[model samples]
Target chain A: MAEDLVLDTAIRDWVLVPLSVVMVLIGVLRYFVSKLLRSSQTPDAKVVREGQLILRARNLRAAGGFIPVKSFRARRFYYTNEENGLLHVPKGQAQNPQAQMFSDPNMAMDMMKKNLSMIIPQSLTFAWVNFFFSGFVAAKLPFPLTPRFRSMLQNGIDLSTVDVSYVSGRSWYFLNLFGLRGLFSLILGEENAMDDTQRMMQMGGGFGVDPTKNLGAEKDGIDIIQHEWTLPKMEQRAEMVLRKLVK
Target chain B: MVGATEEARLNQLESQVDNGGGGAWEYLCLVRKLKARRSEKVLRHGIFILNSHIARSKLGGEEWTLYEQVAVAAMDCHRNDIANDCIEALSKKFPGSIRVGRLKGMLLEAKGAWPDAEKIYAQLLVDNPLDQIILKRKVAIAKAQGNLAAAVEYLNNYLETFMADHDAWRELAELYISIQMYKQAAFCYEELILSQPTVPLYHLAYADVLYTMGGLENLQAAKKYYASTINLTGGKNTRALYGICLSSVAINQLTKGRNKDEKDSADLQPLAAEALLKDYKERAPEKLPLVTAMLRNIKLVS
Candidate 1:
């Protein structure tokens, strides 16, 4: 039954409104920046072929039951045959973790550019919020929260006596950081770079997953499939149905 | 032609926005929807919306997509200048964009600059070997140049890498059929049928190809596929029903005088004939007598 803090109208203008507006503007700016910085380099042929190979292999594994045994065997042999198979990654091929990033300077450079775009704007916004708004408590939330939220919703503040619902300036900035995703998506289209959540996922996706490993996995997948020529079964089924219709 | 009701709905949308009401965004959205549905003859409305300065400014982000769309429609309608303007704008905006480059290549193709278009596509392929658009354009270029064999080669090469692309398989199948390579066409259809066993379209096409092949084994396979098509479509596919009856009769003729094979399709003839007769009776009662007469001539119902 503790009393709620009556937030000043000035806090609304200087803190809350400005924080929201700046977040939006920053999102828009970041989108345009990333769009400009996006490398228009045509994808390499080997990488393209590898992706297509995976897709083809996946399709074979999923739908190979339908094709004739001869065709399926031929495909399996083409992909999984020990010596000259396409999916075969020679074990002698020593994989260096950084080798891909180093060999393809363009790819590494593109990622660097992406990271810079995301990181620079993000840090700048953090710093801007910290500098201007510092320890100023921005607003009070209407709803109650557990004491566990106190540290999260009250980032830059020292006194822990305040309710967990009271959002501090820095925490409000952090809140706006993640919370404005919907607003950003609304203002900018779904594919916009304004989505940090997607960027984080992409970052975690972590480049150069050693294409050899992917190929080997697909190779194993294709190796296990038992070919059941679907047309033969269909013929029998059709014959059975036709026979039954007469009966 | 599109249905009159669809045309009327479009007309209302077009006039309401184009004449007085200021719903440029809504009109643009409708146009985009039409584009998604692949509805042809949106050229006039699209060009009008694109040309209007009011709508132009209001269409944030979607403006470029609209430009690309209208440019394509303009190219299809043979309005080269409009396409040129749209391409110029896109190229200016996204200087080295592959999509814009494609538009440029397509523009060259539209203008009948065969070699130039081919050169652009070749360069695009070189730059991005994985670029399916460029590869597809290469096939298109070969087709446009009246080198169907080359087109087939290019498409085959494309499919060799991208084997899972059903659309590519379908296109290749059609190309094979067009060149009268029924065997190759049948192979493509077989692949299609195998990949998508549930699709009646693939079954029907495979049946057609097998029927065209016309051996005892092929005819039997064709009859089974036709039956599959009928079953998949819940017996509503008239072509499939007809195909079933036709293939069944052909199958019966082939197996005549031979001791009936244990798993023979002799009984399918009557079932398929009955279905076709029932379908014709329900769908087109006027044609039911003619169908009955035809069935009688074929000796299915006698």
Candidate 2:
């Protein structure tokens, strides 16, 4: 009788139905989020971007090995080291009294103008796309591809008992979809599973070189993959765990 | 053989130093009086005189006071080089207060030890990545060696870290031109023009590239750009070169044409040469020897 119940419900309903639902939801979410957070069109960016203009102008002056100071409309900021050179003029003034024989003033001017428009818009767009795609794509994967945050969902680890429910609900979702209850079951298999507490402590997400710091910052590094769900709270202990993890 | 008069003046200054109120200016005047004698001993003794003057300025001595004194001496006696050397020495002794690396770099470049000087510059970049002088030297070395690819790569790397460095792009364009990578050079000039729309020479460089590429085929566009360049530089020497480039473009068309009359061929070719000379005189006055010889060759052909 137990075999019949297992064969009829477990194979027919438990695995097939939920897995299809999860995959569909993942695809829908990816489509919508990608659309919402795309970069603005180029002309819209160019029209009211004075900050970018000033920044580009400064860059241009610096590139030509000339210190460019844009004193536009009475605000003066030296883009180059001004202390060493004494040539100063009123804001928006283009003359270089101290410029030597080999100095190319025209080239300097061209660089300043180019920086004003193209470079700023393109770079800002790139930054926006990078952040948007990384977060959205991570969210929509059908299987829980990211490393689970065990410490974050630990019982009595911090303030409320909310994490207990969250962790159990996530465990249930994985079991229903892929017949694997947690991260170790899905990736490594039960025999080679890391101790639960030890797995919780793994941190720092990725290992790319940071040229400035030379050493990467570890405490909040890549391993802490965040997950969020929104099912109702349950009163019973096991039900609470299920609700917490599923959401 | 010390002069009796100079000896008296030295004794008088030493007595003033003993009295505790003889300032740097007073000592400097005494040194000037000694230097007027024009003897090797007097000149050598002036260093002592100047050092004593510096000592007197310091009862409440501001460094600026000594600096001003040196400036005046440099201008008055044309001892500017000595003053600069002393300033550089003092700056090095106190490294954190000022950057004398650029001054030193320029002096090294002037001495034509560009490769060794570039090592100091490379070290400067490693120590202080944002240092402008270090970047300048890096660009200069790359340009001097005609390593446009390396220069472009270095500048691009600098730009990645220092995104606002517009000068990097300009130098990259110049490097492309230097290496005769004409298409890349034109793109660089275009990038420069985009940043500095008002500058005419950028357009001039761009047109020059098109002319040098296949000549006459792009003559109209070259003429338009050359005209624009002349308009921008207020008819500076660059204008004369623009005219010369135009003449060359026209002559190239005539020479390569299938049917060229004898008189028309001769006139067109020599006109191109004359125009080139006028262009050279305006754009590169110092290159007269090589340019004139080439002009003579063109004259013989015509």
Candidate 3:
């Protein structure tokens, strides 16, 4: 059985240990590289205003009950007004490429910078692992794997008869690259640039997100809130605690 | 160089950090709270904390915030060198950031480079037209240049768009008051009270403005606001109590020969006087006789 074949202790030092250490060091290197490449440019003003509007709308939704009924109604009307409200997007501007809302060219440039930071090191590492550490079983799992894991855990090896748990050299490096995230975070702290998954998620996150759509959503969110003014009740409670109303 | 209370607070802060009870971030937060208005103390302690290698290692993400805080404090204290170093480091971290650009402009403003700071702020405003901080900085610049008209104009422009900005409203009110424009000051205070009616400070300020403007109708309105302030603070605001007494006396004098029954603070005066006496008796027993004499002199206690 393949299980009977004893994994050499030399492999532990030469292959397994070296691969993990190299992966971690590469991660640390990637973090610093990305940190250096990170753009200092701020978001567009329309983006900032839209973000602030959302924040203000969220605050209004939260504290609408604190202000007077008339004040709340005025704010509600100002935001949700159909013809010319802040949240209202005319049909032309909604899809217009000429609009300021869609005119953030730096956003694309920033995304390119992020991708360069993430992709360059990733591809280089993959190439290095392929060239130097290929075709050999560098390590074996202590536990067994299901048949479905055969192609995944034993990449760069051709023989199908070999058991799935027996990991090849390049597969070992791939495993170290993806699986050493917890160890990297422990060393570098959480949310570090060493995180490929975070980068992957971020790469797909921010493109084509229309601020007007978000504002419309916020308007819809604010529409359903029944703002019962709570200040009078709070004042009543204060008076009750003092045992006298000053009037 | 520390005073006794300062030493005590610093020791408490050190103990809070050394005992593992509070981390570096917590110590920074305590430093901010302790010396918020004391620019010299903030600069001293911020530099001390920032220079400490042990604390620097533990700051994580909060180090940048502490740097920004200290930079602002250093600018306030006119320590341009410190602000420069802090802003430089922040720029290295977040290159071309508008936040850092604002800091650079503030540093220029502190160094008396008004034109340079104005240019930077103008560029910043061009980028973010609705920027509240940069607009406020322009107002500050105008004030610094002794251009009161320009400062008022800037504030008025800011208030046009941001009507709910209570700070701008309050600043405009104080500016108007400084210029002896009591009517405009009164309007600002009214906006403040209308938006945040529960705030006793605005009520008190509004009453003061009205009382300063001094007419029969204004006295009545001031008396009503003073009453509201007293109600808001539950008779503890001694100034409001005195305001009530003063406005009532003025009202009585003004309506001396008129139908005083329905037009003055006639019924409310005795209640206000009694509340004032009770407050003085409970809190300042030794001052009770003077308060009683004053109330009696006003003829409300008699």
Could you tell which candidate, 1 or 3, scores higher by lDDT? 1
Clashes of 3: 1
lDDT of 3: 0.77
Which has the better TM-score: candidate 1, or candidate 2? 1
What docking tier does model 3 reach? incorrect
Question: Which window of 10 residues has the lowest lDDT sum in candidate 3 chain B?
Answer: B259-268
Worst 10 residues of 2 chain B by lDDT: B37-46
The TM-score between candidate 3 and the true structure equals 0.62
Stretches > 4 Å off in candidate 2 = A1-54, A57-247, B1-93, B96-98, B101-123, B142-149, B159-170, B215-217, B233-302
Q: What does the i-RMS of model 2 come to?
A: 33.3
Ranking according to TM-score, highest score first: 1, 3, 2
> Residues B1-302, candidate 3, lDDT per residue (tens digit)?
24578667766766765565555455567666655365675676678778987877677777888899889989998889999999999999999788999999999999999999999999988877887899999999999998888899999987756666778889999989988999889877766765576778988898899899999878876777777776677767878878878987897788884745434334456666776777777779999999899878878887
- Sort the candidates on lDDT, descending order: 1, 3, 2
lDDT of 1 at B117: 90
- Cα lDDT of model 3 by residue, A158-191, tens digit: 8887877789988888787778889878888776
> Which portions of model 3 show Cα errors greater than 4 Å?
A1-7, A96-105, A123-194, A244-247, B1-35, B42-134, B145-149, B152-279, B289-302
Model 3, position B178: C-alpha lDDT score: 87
Which candidate achieves the best DockQ against the true structure? 1
Task: Look at candidate 2 and tell me the lDDT of residue B192.
Answer: 68
